[model samples]
Target: NVAVILAGGVGSRAGFSRPKQLVKLGGLPVVAHTIKRFQSHPLIDEICIVSTADHLEEIERLASSLKAHKVKKVLGGGTERRDSSLAAIAAYEHEALSGPLYLIFHDAVRPLVSDEVIDRVINALRHYNAVDVAIPCADTVVSIDQVTNEIISIPDRRSLRLGQTPQAFLHDTISTAYAAALRDPPRAHTDDCGVVLHYLPSEKICVVEGDTYNHKLTYPTDLLILEKFLQSNGGRRKVADTGDRQLTQLRGKSIAIFGGTSGIGEKMAELGERFGAKVSIGSRRNGVDISHAPSVQEFLKEVVATHGKLDAVVNSAAVLTYQPLEALSDEDIVSSVGTNYLGALHVARAAYPYLRESRGHLLFFASSSYTFGRAHYSVYTSSKAAIVNLTQALADEWDGADVKVNCVNPDRTATPMRTRAFGHEPQDQLLDAQTVALDALSVLVGETTGCIFDVERR
Candidate 1:
């Protein structure tokens, strides 16, 4: 299967001086995110990008930085979107006669395309020649008169669907459709599916389910919405369980754990040692204050100096205060934000050089309250949310350098921090610290980044 990323548009609608595809969303360019989806997919055999002439060299550099090995061609596209699609199709024209080929057309701006959508399209191609992805329309559809600006006809909402990308077609099917389309091209036709439907009337174009998060980046506000989506896992649904699996990857690796004096951090450090990792623990008890940049930087510098390298750094250091906004003390607000939010920032900044050198992993901890604000723990909840955002931004920023960044959003856990805030909870009702620690270790060794692992008791 070949993935064709159409990035020819100037994106004047997005109000950017440059094309929106080159705009940085999380940390990388928007097109980089789209390319990564297909590049990492096991089923995708090759990737071809149709970029404008002015940005061709820049896109090539971006692909090279990402190590996009599957990118076979970065051809120059024409003025229209259809012309870009034709360029991708024409690239494989000679090769199509040798064997079967599947072409998946997708917009470079729609970076949130999920694996499920791609799978559905590929599966449908086995039974049908053409396939498209779309979601059921939630809004009412009305045909409006252009000149009078009045409603002409109302279409049933159930019959309406908003089209999305990763539209797939067999090599011969789309080629034949475009060949006929060139004789008298439709003026306003934008999608490949429409061309197939109009030219090849007998060919059936199947519709597959598309995710709501798989939206194209058009307006400026869409950038903020997509960033939030990426922070919230970007349409990933599976929750991982370590289940007593052996972490062989941790053996002989160097790990630095902050807030390792007690609680989840302590448990993680113990497990790291048990698994043969060269563990370096730090906390206020050991003259390491995460809230202080110099203190955190000095600790990491010593860890690297002692261990000879740093493979991973985990920042579980956090302060939680339960108090109403009106009754909270100035000291309470400062401590919570400083330790939880700014501390994560400091750790990321200090650890980047080492992690980038080793292509290492950086992990942070967030609470379940990060998704929403709680009454008494407003500052604490907001700080956790900030941590989630920081993890995603850093993941994008360091993707080219091969540094992985992720966060663990554990539910109410039986930790010393929780006991201090709300004492004496039932053991069964709370997640064990060891369980959460195991999950964190799995993330450190796993290949996923810019994700939130939710640890909930079964």
Candidate 2:
């Protein structure tokens, strides 16, 4: 893969003394920062900078000052943006270059393209054969006649996506598109995607959601906003001294599911194990009893001793009641609440210290009835609701300690409890317990720390 940065733009509109690409942002030249970003990427074989004839030498000097690697300078200054872009494309097609490679065309003015976004675009191009990064247009737009300057019609912005770069393409796909454009270029076309869509089939173009901060530095005022964004996100976007582009990999991350024998708990364990996590499956048959407090505590201790650390704990084991309000005696309420609500609390509390050590996550399972009160399940619903509040309170206390507490309120899942509540059916397409558990697992692994996720997996 190769990254082509179009740094040949003249900042006439911005009225800056220097080219916009050379404008200092966050104490570094904007194009220098942009090249530095991709220079370290493992997938990016080389980084080529297309600068105007006047600024080529200065751009190379700026790169040298930054100690940027994997950079090659190309002399280019065109009357139009498309011409400069084509020059970069030509450098990508040189006889010395590799054939059928993935090429990413990015604007040097947009210096906020993080390593994560670059990796994502590369991954998409590898998978889909062609892809473009874009953000959905958030404003209403009107189409006007060019001659009369009169509004013709209001276009639906909901279906419109504002294109951003690095627009990824196959070496052949982009090479062919630009070759055709040079032969008979369209007067109204602006971006590379426009050329591709005009010449290539519609199915050839694919869109990926782009970051909102990835805006082109078109005007003078925009540079100030870009600088501010860089200052705020400097810690996250700054290139490492080693120039390694690999972000934090999820290897050796141990996620132990307490009560991972069946239902949602079992599904979560399977996923944890699948994602290269050291999964410790706990079940009564395996001598990890969920009913008795002492036995449960001892089992948890064993897990902690074995793993030496825990990354996440998902407590999906719960007891349910199906009796009507009148038929639900105090014993029924006590049994249901003690096992479902108290069991969650016990597991979370027992794992709190271990979780704090690793900044682990604690996930609880609640029923959708906790939100929508249903008939004949008052005791179960109330018990689950208590778990929700427990999660909130625990999250509040553990906020500063780096421990996350969250709950999943699943609806009508195809589990043993669902059969007890809704009874047997010929063919009821209820939510898949595994799907719900996996979705909740993803949430637990993500940055959404404290919240109740109402999941319905159909």
Top candidate by TM-score: 1
Clashes of 1: 0
The sequence of per-residue lDDT tens digits that candidate 2 reaches over residues 1-458 is: 77888888888988998888888875568887688667656778877778888887898887776566677655575867787777766766763254567768899998877666787798788566578888888898999999999999999899998888988888778778878877884567777778788877653677877887786888888987886555333223211122222212335676667668877788767766666677787666687655567766787677778877777787777777777889978887777776787777778778888889998888887776775566778777887778877876787679668798877776667776667766885435567766676677666656545466666533
Instruction: Report the error of model 1 at residue 397, Å.
Output: 4.9
| Candidate-wise lDDT, in order | 0.90, 0.73
TM-score of 1: 0.78
lDDT of 1 by residue, 286-343 (tens): 9998889999999999999999999999999999887788888898888888899888
Clashes of each: 0, 0
Pairs that collide, model 1: none
